[model samples]
Target: MNKSTLALAVAVGVLAQQAGAAGFIEDSKASVSSRTMYFNNDNRDGGADQKETAEGLKFDYLSGFTQGTVGFGIDAQALVGIHLDGGKGHHPYPSSFFPSDSDGSAASEWSRASANVKARFSKTEAHLGGALQPNMPILVANDSRLLPQTFEGGTISSKEIDNVTFNVGQLEHAAGRASSNSTGLAVAGGTEESNQFRYAGADWKVTKDLTLQYYHANLKDYYKQDFLGLVHVWPIGTNQSFKTDLRYFDSSSDGKNGDAGYQFNNNGGFAKTPGEVDNKTWSAMFTYTLGGNAFLLGHQRVNDDGGFVYLNQGSVVNDNRRSEEAGGASFYLFTDSMINGFVRAGENTTFGQYSYDFAALGVPGLKASAAYLYGDNIKAKNGTSPDQSEWERDLRVDYTIQQGVLKGFGTTLRHGTYRGSDTGIASQDQTRLIFNYTYSFL
Candidate 1:
């Protein structure tokens, strides 16, 4: 245990010894999940072809705090693993959250753990700590695997007004989902550090059917970002409803935009690039629901330059690593999902989706959905004007027994197919399946 962990344990131990104070743990929720994944790829782009299978086990716990209005809480997580089948040559990305070394090979096992301390009030809460994941549009901690990614930061949230909420945070470091070691800033060119990583936002309901949101973020020497979101819901009939969502982000702020310094383009020995990049990103998605069926179509675009900036490996003090961030479009960065946490740095994108709920079909807690996305005119900085195109198809099936011998048992299966013209990374196809169970212990 590190010094911080020891300090927390001591504090909790002391509190538990008080007159009427509760034990260190006020409440606890536990879960265990399993996954079987198959990944294969035939890259005609010179990288080694990959074909492998993996199995993983994850144990998660969310703990509550001791008694009192001015309470102190600690949240900790632990992940363990065993690599079923992956070789050095045909190594699959680790079954955990992050990618292994560029070599593609992975160790037989790996794990990650994180924790945080928080304080709360009637309508406001503040947390200052490390080893936690923050998931938001502007700065999302990628958590799409057996183990979720974590970051070192502090965040504050307040709901002191009617139909309105506010959030602000500052992050200084990031730890990938599969590793226990913490790393410095990751930006465009390389890793450096400074007084950066600050963000703020607000979400408000304007009426019965409309909601408005705004967000702003900065990454020291990296690019700064601003975003606006609007949503509306309308009832088409007794069983049909229409939902509309629109969002936009601005790529002008500190760093290259906020007057911090210059961004890297070709790496000509600190000489500086010629011009600056300003981005305007927007997306509109609409979903039509009828009984157990839902159909959705959406469009998202990223203007000239690139996508928003955040932490990366080996990067500190905020820098731009446009080396692989070929852009001109903006759909991948805004997609929120249960898999593949965040997909950014692409040009124009168009997507269509359909989902079915078994509840309307006589089964409760069962649902399935599939989506397809296509992007083109991707601008690459490596002098390769290949108007490369890529497409992805995803399917998910989930079933939870409404009532029976096993009242609340559940299972989920996900399938994905991705193929593209040498889009910098190897093209491939993948499939994943998961089995989960939850029991109440109150």
Candidate 2:
């Protein structure tokens, strides 16, 4: 067993002895969530199309802290995914949506379980185990698929100060959204694993409507990244407001970053120093909200040196075989869209979105949004071909049952169309329909 697994076993054993403790048994909570998803992608090029439907069931148990100065608690999660439909030809090998069988077809089903031990002291809390899902400015756990990506790590968060919240963590391995196994961390094109990913950050709420964030992260022998973010809201009326959000990232090579088996693909775009991580990216977004309607606009620029970098284990080889199911990842950027990430070197992208809630029209649980992104001036490899460009359009609709026996049940539909010019990326159209429901048991 791995260290994290062993740790979880020991922690659970200790918790079982205290199972009858006053606070532990009284304040525990459990929940089960279900998601049914239909995913379809049509490749405009000669690539194979993917269409599949799957059902995901997730169970979570959160135990309250034991009664003491330094209280102890535990969180456990179990996930199961069942393949509802997808023929041989439609279920692609090495897919990002589901694990593959020995014959390269989609697996019938997959499941995994994880647990974490936590402690609380004053206004601070610490967690250690294999089910860490962090949502920070530097690393955002991906939950856009059937299951969420999880990490085996230890983290500490403290809100002892009045307006400042601090977070620090070190992660060793990650279980991909579609995989039943865990693997060490790596970048997009990296074949060798980096066992260490450390990060620290803080969020300061300066005023009631303003907040600032800063974070630094390093993947041992891979790359180091720093991020800065600012958000502010100006209230005009009870239901009208203007919001501004700014984000910046600076990334560079770390020890042995450009070596063989550790190369960075630069997101399949041009790189000044090939295989090396060197980048500076910034983005600005503005939003105006009135009643139930919102309008948002944003612009992002990637420096000329390289593409934006983030932790992606897609190319990692494990146990003498390629772990293709461990491929999907998310970054802290507006361009991290459903179809593509417009983060190539020298790329400048402008995007806008308009969304409205139907409550303004007497429907309280319906919403719709449409977004468009256009990117140009992407640096071509070797500076030989003309700069590439790409564009994407997305539409989404969501609704929930507000009353009756099915209250809290929700449905979402999303579609995206993408086209690019000589960028080595495929042109595709994608659509997803999802049904979500959660039940709480205490």
Could you estimate the TM-score for every candidate? 0.79, 0.98
Poorest 10 consecutive residues of model 2 by lDDT?
Answer: 1-10
lDDT of 2 by residue, 1-442 (tens): 7676787788888888887888886899999999999999999998999999999999999999998898889999999999999865998888879999999889999999998999899999999998999999889899998988999989999999999999998999999999999899999999999989999999999999999999999999999999999999999999999999999999999999999999999989899899999999999999999999999999999999999999888899999887779889999998899899999999999999999999999999999999999999999977668999999999999999999999999999999999999989899999999999999988
Query: Could you give candidate 1's per-residue lDDT for residues 1-442 as a string of tens digits?
Result: 5344465566546544542446335465666666555545545456665655555565666555556776666665666655566545775343233236545466557766666666667778776556656766676665455455566667888999989889998776665555555555445444344435888998899898999988888776666778888889998998899999898877653554323333532111111122233557678899999999999998877553544344444323323432111111112253543322123334577888999998997888999999988766555544345555567778889988878777777777877766666555455555555555555453
TM-score of 2: 0.98
The clash count for each model shown is 22, 0
Identify the leading candidate in terms of TM-score.
2
- Among these predicted structures, which one has the highest lDDT? 2
Off by over 4 Å in 2: none
- Reference-based lDDT, residue 53, model 1: 57
